[model samples]
Target: MRRAWWKEAAVYQIYPRSFCDSNGDGIGDLNGILQKLDYLQELGADVLWLNPVYDSPNVDNGYDIRNYRAILSEFGTMEDFDRLLSEVHRRGMRLVMDLVVNHTSDQHPWFISSRSGRNSPYRDYYIWKDPSPGGGPPNNWGGCFGGPAWSYDAGSGQYYLHLFTPEQPDLNWENPAVREEVYDMMDFWFQKGIDGFRMDVISMISKGGYADGPLRPDGLYGDYTGQCANGPRVHEFLKEMNRRVLSRYDCMTVGENSAVTPELACRYAGFDEGELNMVFHFELVDVDGGETRRWEREHSWKLTDIKRVLTRWQTILDGRAWNTLFWGNHDQPRPVSRFGDDSTEENRVRSAKMLALCLYLMQGTPYIYQGEELGMTNTRFTGIAEINDVQTRNAYWERTERLGVSHEDMMRVVNYISREHARTPMQWTDGANAGFTVGKPWIALNPNYPKINAQRQLGDPDSVYHFYRKLLSVRKKSDTLLYGHYQLLLPDSEEVYTYTRTLGGEQILVVCNFTGKEAAYSLPGGWAGAELLLSNYGNPCSGTALRPFEAFALRHSG
Candidate 1:
């Protein structure tokens, strides 16, 4: 297999807004991240994938880009960003910024000009259409947050498409001018010595003729993913982007493609494909919510279902294209709570390590969200008012007000699936506000911070933080872990997940118990008495009986 810096590196995703507060001003800033660089280095992170810090109105927590070149005042100044980049590079860690060109804030200068008149110079910068005969939206598509995807512009007498919120208008990538602007903005960052980009909602850049998608049972709005994701010219535009700007720098690029399949991923990030280095497909994350609606009632996901999804991606993309391994991110619920047992302290630690061993040992670049190292679980939100996420707030209102669902029931779903769970302030210490800030936090911290804070974990050798450090250290030293061929073992097992990675004469075996109860599994042939590289449980016996949430990696060489 071909080797690259990105292929062997593990990325640490930092949601700056909730990471740490530097000025005691509630919000996390670039200086906050600058302060945490040593913490990340201690955890063995090679790359840092920062969430959007661009100038914005905070409608979608900085996803709505007001100015691609300017840094948000709340985040820090341009000089602060430059210092952060310099410090990151000085520490031998690369930094990747979030690229949110799929949409721009309605207040953006381009959008402001586009909405001024029908024949404005920037009119083609955004997707605008006349009302569909009856004086409503241009299409039946629904915004990702809620309501119609098309928001009316009284000045232009046309409705513009926004897949997310009315404040976030979709960009017209079909225009060569828009594409050039985006590429030039990218070059601006590359010229600043920043390492790479994490493209947000990259698959939705192309639209499929603005056709009406299939309506849901409620008949409010049509499916946006069906009409927009992986559109006709996506690959062509990506190739153009690669040719124009990305090829000039030795950079790492990972696209946030929520609607991609393994085949589509191959085209986007295949070995010979010049588009991106890797892609974040939502198949594993979407298991509980499915493709259409994620805010509804929780869907029961089984171990076999997870196995099927992970095995497919691991095997299919083994030699075709690279994969990105992550359990949770800024937009998803916590991993220990969603995929593992987080009901108890012991369970949280064990399962967090188990999940780490299960996913990180697979063939891919691993991404660790900020608080995930401390085994942060989902937040227990009691009321809608406490939630800070726009999507969660919209879903709560839609379900309780219009759909006639009970408040208690909808809040239950919010507790289970809300993105707010991951957006809670990072738990640095057991002090007030979890050491995230001294002043009021923009959002509430996860209440379990007293027990699960990073300060507490960093001091303990058996903590989840140390486990992750060891796991990454192990990965850094093993060529087999980076480029080995993956094979699923015990594919049908419901309680235990096992896999092996082999490169030439070197082999690494990973075993994980996904449940709270002890599971039984026999070692495969020629695997007895293998050298134990790492294990969550202390000095666990190499016996058939696996403890609850036990995970370990064994090495074999012949």
Candidate 2:
């Protein structure tokens, strides 16, 4: 109903650790991101959402914040971060920092004081409870990174709650002091001129009092997602956050909401709610995974299923709420690997372009992860030793040892769904380490970099990188693509995903062939003479059948 700057802007998410290395430290830093500002501007991104670069033990790769006001020593000094912010603004781009407030690193000073004794003032800064009568965790809740959610602290003789790894202790959001501190920390950044935050696991900040949950079939611990995710006080806390700090600033806020539905999403991101500008819901990405158990097994998701998931969000949130459009991120496998065919070079480039045309043309703010525009494919990790993500390691142990699954089978699943797949160093050049770093990479680089690096694609007009640039340019100029109404076409077609966007007197028809073979696609009756605005294959189609992975956007020139 109303227009917002964020709604019209495109966001590019940078996993800083893998973006580039400036000091040859084998890790990406603020200076490295500063060096890439021109590259981002050339790509037509108006917003840059960088992953966490705060002081951390890196137990969960910067999600565990040891200090709210400090930058990681490895990532450079605060002055470097200041210069980064300055340069981003100078180039007419906004910077959105990754805000991790649901938990603090166990090594944080507050956690250190809280674990000192039972009566310490900071003790309530975290959730601490006496162990169950049987001398185990306070409840049967399982940590997302594996094992019990409560870790025993021998000194205090109490257990602390951690929804993720034990190194990341859940913060007590119910405590007024804690909430005040969080808001204060947020203000500290807003004062520093950050455009906004991509709040990590923001929905899990509030918990409905600790309790045992339904046990998994393995009988080790219970799934606490229901009890913890989008907990009772989540909205209350978010609303208070807005009233205190966010509303005062003219900025954007997106929450990492895991277990949210469209109805609930409306409340969190509704324009009038003053909670969040948008929220990243995983329904579209989690299409293959089971409802509660993700990455435990592999699944074959159909094109119709993906269409259903996306169309629902588009139609419902069109005017009521907002959505964040993304296919890959630091926590997801590459889109070409997960949703497209990456078996061959041609297919990789074609499908990558197809997927981009499908999502970028939708009605929402689109986020492009680093290297995604280069048509990067998943890494071929040989063994468990090659992975670095804590979640992936935990899942390996759970599926193989705890669930009695075979090692080969578990590795197969990891190969397909591991977050490590997305953490590979950015492939800049087809040189050593994909030109990401002169020293050893902090993580492995996808071997396909030689064939899919940016150096090879930047000059090629038909490359995925250029295609994405064209898409962003088109979106910038076309009101219909940015704010138009979305209507699903051929909703039940398994081979073709089609949609139309209309605004005022303009209408654009989009058709995507979602398969490895040529798909029989026909114009939607009266749209036969529509003017072709975009396409993956060279020029407009000569016939109705689209080539393998072919995609097109047609504007009805009526």
What is the number of backbone collisions in each predicted candidate, taken in the order shown? 0, 0
User: What overall lDDT, based on C-alpha atoms, would model 1 receive against the true structure?
Assistant: 0.90
TM-score on alpha carbons, each prediction: 0.98, 0.97
Candidate 1 least-lDDT 10 residues: 211-220
Evaluate model 2: give its TM-score.
Answer: 0.97
lDDT of all predictions: 0.90, 0.89
Model 2: which residue pairs collide?
none
Which regions of candidate 1 deviate over 4 angstroms? 211-221
Candidate 2 lDDT tens digits, 1-558: 688899999999999999989999899888999988988899999999989999999999999999989999999999999999999999999999999988999999999999999989999999998888888877778888778888999998999999899999999998999999999999999999999999999989988759553244434445666788899889999999999999999899999997888888999999888799999998988788733555566677888889989988998998999878999899888999989999999999999999999999999999999989898888887788888899888888777886798888888888888888899999999999988999999988888788888888887888999999999999888889988999998888899999999998889998898999988877777777678888998665668788899898999745
Error of 1 at 140 (Å): 0.8
Off by over 4 Å in 2: 211-221
| Cα-based RMSD of candidate 1 | 1.4
lDDT for position 149 in model 1: 86
